[model samples]
Target: MILKTILSGKHYQFKSVKDVMAKANEEKSGDTLAGIAAHNMQERVAAKVVLSQLTLNDVYEHPAVDYDHDEVTRMIIDDLDPLVFRQIKGWTFEQLREWLLATTTTNDIIHYLSQGLTSEMIAGVCKLMTNLDLITAAKKIINEKTANTTIGRPGTFSSRLQPNHPTDNLRGIMASTMEGLSMGIGDAVIGLNPVNDTVSGVTAILNTFNEFVTRWQVPTQTCVLAHVTTQMQAIEDGAPAGLIFQSIAGSQKANTAFGIDQHLIAQANQLGKQALQNKGQNVMYFETGQGSELSSDANFGADQVTMEARCYGFARHFDPFIVNTVVGFIGPEYLYDAKQVTRAGLEDHFMGKLSGLAMGCDVCYTNHMKADQNDIENLALLLANAGCTYIMGVPQADDVMLNYQSTGFQETATIRELLNLHPIPEFETWMEKIGISQNGRLTSKAGDASIFMEKESM
Candidate 1:
């Protein structure tokens, strides 16, 4: 494959496919910190020029991590439909990009083409897309998965209500949960990032969530973002978990740092299926982020975009109920500022949708980063327009436990109204019954958490 190109009378030479992938990416602090990003704009364009001409087969042959050495690479390659791959193997990245944007490419067509794509090819095409290109192409694809209720249906927007407290206080957590549900959020899930990751602590929280959801007849799933083993143990001890949750990485070594592997994830899925029988078919929820592999020293010298795309490729093997990137939570070291964070959020969402997963974004930032609530809100709106399946809904967009800012419950409610979107059909019906919403808009009673308390008294 050609890794050399000329741009505006300047010559640029990339050392490898990996090098081309890194340099071609739009500006990211992680890439620069990794010492792989282009030194100047001219070289960045030059890298893109060279990458645009590379064939799908060229990328396929040079997996970011060798198949022999990495299970993620193997899973990405082995799961591809051989028949579909043959038809598109010879197409150049430029050709693939144009075809995706062509009027002839319908959602069904793009979905079919996705069966043949490897993560490397997906990442390669992603680097060549402009910001609007990312939005336009992603908007055409709808990937839906069901755990307790369905998500990603057309005209639907959803939120994962995150009732996280600095301490795992059940009353405080429930207060937040009631408020979030009253605002017409939590249709996607009511998951928590536990302050305590122990089996007992996780089980207690899951049991409380299960009881509340059951009593209120909330049509959503509940999970505690504990380690996979802790969750498994909790489930084994009879905790009612609708979906098993884990944080995945793009490389085997990074996954190891997260204390997971394909075998472990597969085992968790099996346990989750048996536990959640008759509830839903898709039983796994995965979280990923750009720069995670780099953070763990496991990127194999690949760019964060390529590494992040590999995460989707790995995640698809399990047919996860939801897969979202915790964009910006990794802090300024990887994303730097609002512009970089916004770009990564868009790229990750687009790449995840193209990989055929129910995708969401955390739409968040750190206090130290050069960003504010406005930047997170802007990215949230963009992703919503791009057909994102769900986003996190923390109270006032602040997670005291996780120590970051994300999309708030009120923000989600407003976005649903502004975009003319509704929650999952069943959950929306439940909201109507409770007088929290009517005709897809929040009612006067929507903001009152005491509604549930009144019901409890009755």
Candidate 2:
């Protein structure tokens, strides 16, 4: 895999709110960074850790150990640092050299690489080692971004901790996710009345415009889905006439408790469809695996679990009249029949973590990844290299966008006001295929849904 994922510009690509705003027309929502950072936090972390371990074990290594960061931080990274050998908790330059010489590891004293080192710490280290200029440059970039940044609040996306999430990336994206969702949190309930029922027959479907996310024990951001497949329809159909709305609403509420955020609505409009299709290449994929572990949807129960196992994509390309469900309702067991499937040997506890590049969040990390998160990073690198865009089943991924409430999809805003979000260029046509209206604000007849979802395969 490539060492880093570079855009056409080669440097890490980032666009502020203003950048996208400048390009948008009256009908267009100028911001859509979701296309860029759409990958899950866990997947990214998994990729990062895997890459770091691969690099440290093979490509590069510090000649000595160092103790400069927090006490826990120092211990966690001591074996790999190169400048300070023994003394920690603030050591002078003289103390640094003497300790390095005393250590048996190496006298060559090459590079010092550590995790969670703030730009300030890097600057101090830079002052001591003139040869390590590259580190200084990287640190400078970090310093500029965090110059006056505030921290994430409790129950916020950024505040939730990943054992080894890159601090810089986490801080930046969490803020964005938290803010976006905070702005407009609304779900449309699409219920239809059928001609035959004594009571008004209806089914509720949920939909939302922001990049949908969910948690899978650990904070991971991968591919999450708002799907309505044969299985979902059966549930909706089986329920009482008017009760379908309550059922859908209850399902969503339940999902929220399990770290899943689902919205009920008609399909996207014309432009919105294309955007979702373009960005969500693996729209229907989820984290699959054998046995109930940390990744088990069993924690969510049968009704929800069935939703993940049986639901297909909402688009007509898969099935028509489909409504998207929340994230938690799906889990890992749907992915594998064998108990052997796992990520980093964590026993597939994170059953939701697996599959797809840009379109997944719940890939199974199992017992193995938990044992060594570097394994997770390596995974991230592979997915990043593959050009895949998302991951859904990890906890951090969902929390990164939701709990923080920094910036995300809000129901009240128009296409322009919502930052980094846009309706698909041809969303309405896609909705029409299901007999739904253009804006997703109107509902179609129940018989129409039965006709639209006539196909069972995705």
| Model 2 TM | 0.21
| Location of the lowest summed lDDT over 10 successive residues in candidate 2 | 142-151
Candidate 1: residue 376 lDDT (0-100)? 92
Distance from true location, Cα of 211 in model 2, Å: 14
Stretches off by above 4 angstroms in model 2 are 1-287, 290-361, 364-372, 393-458
Worst 10 residues of 1 by lDDT: 449-458
lDDT of each: 0.92, 0.23
Compose the digit string of candidate 1's lDDT tens values, residues 1-458.
88998777877889999999999999999999999999989899999999999999999999999999999999999999999999999999999999988877999989999999999999999999998899989999988888888889999999999999899999999999999988988999899999889999999999999888888888899999999999999999898888899999999999999998999999999998888743568999999999999998999899999999999999999999999999999998899999999899999999999999999999999899999999999999999898999999999899999899999988888888899988999999999988888877889998899899865622
User: For all candidates, what are the clash counts?
Assistant: 0, 116
lDDT of 1 at 14: 91
Superposing every Cα of model 1 onto the true structure, what RMSD results? 1.0
